[model samples]
Target chain A: MAKEKTSALHENKGVSQPKDTNTRAIKNIRTKRNTKLNTKALVASILKSDTVALSRAITLIESNHPSHIKQANAIIKACLPYANQSIRIGVTGVPGVGKSTFIEAFGKYLTSKGKRVAVLAIDPSSSLSKGSILGDKTRMEALVKDEHAFIRPSSSGDSLGGVARKTRESIILCEAAGFDVIIIETVGVGQSETTVHSMVDFFLLLKLAGAGDELQGIKRGIMEMADAVVINKADGDTLKHAQLAKVEFNKALQLYPIKASRWKPKVMLCSALQNEGIDSVWKLISDYIAITSKNHYFEKKRQEQNKFWLIQTIETQLKSHFFNRPDIKKELEQQLELIKANETTPFAAADYLLNL
Target chain B: MAKEKTSALHENKGVSQPKDTNTRAIKNIRTKRNTKLNTKALVASILKSDTVALSRAITLIESNHPSHIKQANAIIKACLPYANQSIRIGVTGVPGVGKSTFIEAFGKYLTSKGKRVAVLAIDPSSSLSKGSILGDKTRMEALVKDEHAFIRPSSSGDSLGGVARKTRESIILCEAAGFDVIIIETVGVGQSETTVHSMVDFFLLLKLAGAGDELQGIKRGIMEMADAVVINKADGDTLKHAQLAKVEFNKALQLYPIKASRWKPKVMLCSALQNEGIDSVWKLISDYIAITSKNHYFEKKRQEQNKFWLIQTIETQLKSHFFNRPDIKKELEQQLELIKANETTPFAAADYLLNL
Candidate 1:
């Protein structure tokens, strides 16, 4: 197989050879190797909280410029020993649930308690615009000014789940940088919430106080995956409704089978704008960790999550590769139209496309 | 690719060079071609309501006798024009919802209305049996005795979804066998429900009325996919509760986005044993067809379904082929264990495996 790949690459090169092509290829390969080595050294320095090196390393990893993945892998290897020390939390909610506002207030509370906090926001829509709401540091003024807090908004390009992959890798980098907590904030779409939950230690679902129909609109699968539920914006006139909504949610959650950890998820009310109940939210998560770790379920769960992700990543990549093949793409489109016209069955169409 | 495969076959023939091996290979190729022709002929006879040929054709399709897939595709192609004329309804609910009993009663109703009915029961647990529950036709004595009703049960397989694929193909065969209505009965398991829904024209979710946590136990996504919600066993003491459940489901359905058909799904009560409200359920389906067809949504939805199955089938086959490659298996397993240990990110592991 390796020989086959090499031969294919050579064949490609043979087809494209022109003046300076060989020299350009050699130069490209050398630069890629050097970039990888530099990124590794930069990552090691960042572990000691060198902000300048950390920023540069992240920029190199995020770039689509040549050899970005090679450099990214090297940096990740160097940072491995210092990573996995933090509590990874993922927060998601429906649109208009004040997710950004809540995160700013929550980050401030963690920093106040002498904890170094890292925030990675994944906004799927920002992929095209590359302009994220959280990218504007002024929006999160309090936490942004805190020396212990670091907030990096999502980058452009890729699916919501792709943004999640980058954020997950960033969490390891942040943990290596001595951050005690890594918070992943996702765009409040249902599909994105599932992606965020798969990568985090604890998944927090936020809800508005009195959104009756909105509660129903949220899929129960998303709710069942939640480790903690926070009724956000629970202040003043919304206080009574928040309490009621909490009870309803608790009742709904009771229908699900007990989670593997055997710990019943906690439901709490929080006013993210007023900074109320922010401490309680962190305390609940600490309690959850303590309980699961004592039972040795924490390590087991994380290991299982890693296995899930490994299979998922392979499947996704293989699908992309298969679809990207020029011949397969054209055949697939033609066969689809044939099936639509009832000139063929899906099974036969599949056989033909796969053989092609 | 075709030339390579043919050459590989020629190489195998050369290497073996045994009289018995040569004879067996010749026989195998002959049986494959013969089966294909047989299936094509069987499809025509089946459409004329030749029950014996229909049974034999399905047996030839489901057999693992080396020539099955070729024969299956031939039968499917011959049946293509006749299939899709029937309303393919997929029914699922929890165990107590009485799926088998409901199917028996429902089949009887359709047969009585002069609509030849076919019931295909997909039991995920059948993987170990290599046999079907329909062998005990006594369980559905009334429907089994009806000249217009036919019942076939699940086939053993490695994957639940794979088993479903064959069953769906069998549905097309049954439609060609002059069955005007095909009811696919699947187990109540959530994952299997999605598989069955993807292949059918309409999905009916059956629920027992007295279940206290009905709304919470069934995910909203399942409800959204359902074209109708039936509160089954709605006789005698359960009548009032069934009515209440119907109202609850109706309210829940309102929260979902309107289905593409723009024909609002209805909630109804039925007692399959008592044979109550079966006609009304049929009427509701007919009404749905009429409204959706009038607006041209029916053909559009069918086209989208065809495209979905075409892509899904291709992806499934590609994954299976890639994983089944002998040389890659051991390395893949080793990498998986490393991934489980968190020694490497899933993305990096996938890159290593695919590029290996």
Candidate 2:
């Protein structure tokens, strides 16, 4: 009776939805791997297409430690010159819309064409969802096992801005590692879609044809951000429905002014499971690149994206510094009450906080 | 010049596009009217429904001088208790879509029904466009003379955020002056439409019956923000076209999910010049208010709006302070060059600036 069994849960032996408790081991590994690595060697290895070095550099980038951050910055700067030649495309869709399968087929197509492919994700909800984006090794087992492909889950962060910045930086690392095509995937939530759109050369939206109401669950402004909208699962009973959705989407796209890229967004039908329509999707993207390059829109758009990111980054930091102050957080609640009670104007309340 | 006299241009006596040289008179008037007025007295006068006091308060808010800002803040805080009772409606359209005429007809209709109306504008481009919004005193002759109606031109500022803040404060003073209906007019430009949409209770979009492309000039997110889409000038030759346009617009609006207010935006035909269909617009708005109030979305949206404005103001100020610093401004340009040349990542650049 006195020799009762100790709880395995307290000893970390019980494995049920485990997280947050084992970060010590991971932190130790990060420190051991990163302590002696200089930025120049990392850049040289990545430039030579060393996959292990590429993965380690990304780990340094995804690290929140100050020393890792300094190293990641130097490596990113050194690798930037080698990063501009790859085609960085973004793919987005809802949760159950077969993103993993479509991505597998598409990556395999690219790899079979003698091209190296890299798949990265920008899931802001990854932490809560347990890194679900590209989390399961079996989801795209073929793509993962392909020697010419690299897949990485999203970087966990307290904010989408932080996650997006990390993902955006990781793109440069992948490109420098000699990936011919880099696919950044995001779920079809609003802010993340906009973030991915700003960073990518082309954006592809995947949809499932509905019984009716083809627009359901589609966030506002998403249909406009898309360079091409693909109706997935068009091979079975949903073929006719997918055709109808194509018409509906075309009409909806017509409602928007033509993009500055001078490329009209298209609606295509695809069957990822059957591996149908995958070639046409690649062709559509290639045609877009060719046309935009001829008109000089492709280079101009990349320059614009760079400027946009720089400005956006500064603004986010400025706001974050102010909002995270201990006194400001305490005072904001009191001001909100005053605002609801009609005793202070919002601008006046803001002034009070700024002065504090 | 023949007599060796000074030229009219040099003497500021020419009848040309004169600006930036004749502000003395206006500044003197502002100082004379506002220097001695206290916040409590101004609030009392506004509560007594003094239009002159309300106008003066708005003029103070529009001033950029430090003393004027201090006084304006006090007055706005004092007037807060009397605000939040009015129904604010935002009307927006392209330049040629006849906004002035529609607003005039709508304002007259409200006054005729014994409702006190106040019309305000939020044109960020007012400084460049010479205050075209409500600038022409003759544009709404009947409504301008209506005893129950008050119309004010947009407040001019170098930034949209500045102008929007001024207009938002003016809204409180107008409500305190006993106006039951406040109409905020904004041109269908992207940022201004969003700013107006955030401040008002209802957003009305005015559209022309296009030759074929009905959604031609509508901005990307404007349609989603609209509570109602009115096909203006639906008389004479365009009458049949307006009917077809109504069907087109109805289809377009249906594409958007229902709003948080649970209101389905409607498409109606109106001839502002002929004063037709004006009452229906009012009836539609009343119906919207009734439903939203029943669902408590009306109150909830306003509360959310207040909290949103509070945070927005703080963020805007934080950004402005950071960007306006002389050292930061100089370094930002240099950082942009580095970013374009791919010598640094945006996040790293931002951190450098933040530390500086």
Q: Identify the leading candidate in terms of lDDT.
A: 2
Candidate 1 structure quality by residue, lDDT tens digits, A72-179: 777876786677889989998877888888988889888888999988877876766846757666677887777888888777676765776777778778888999
Model 2 pairs in collision: none
Q: Which pairs clash inside model 1?
A: none
Docking quality (DockQ) of candidate 2: 0.54
After superposition, candidate 1 runs with Cα above 4 Å error: A1-37, A94-101, A128-131, A211-219, A233-241, A271-274, B1-41, B96-105, B128-135, B211-220, B337-343
For each candidate in the order shown, give its overall lDDT on alpha carbons.
0.80, 0.88
Model 2's C-alpha root-mean-square deviation from the true structure amounts to 10.6
- Candidate 2 Cα outliers beyond 4 Å, as residue runs: A1-34, A37-44, A95-98, A156-158, A206-219, A229-258, A264-296, B1-34, B37-45, B95-98, B207-217, B229-255, B263-295
* Worst lDDT 10-window in candidate 1 chain B: B4-13
Compared with the true structure, what per-residue lDDT tens digits does model 2 show for residues B209-308? 8687787657778899999999999999999889999998899988777788889999999999999999999999999999999999998988888888
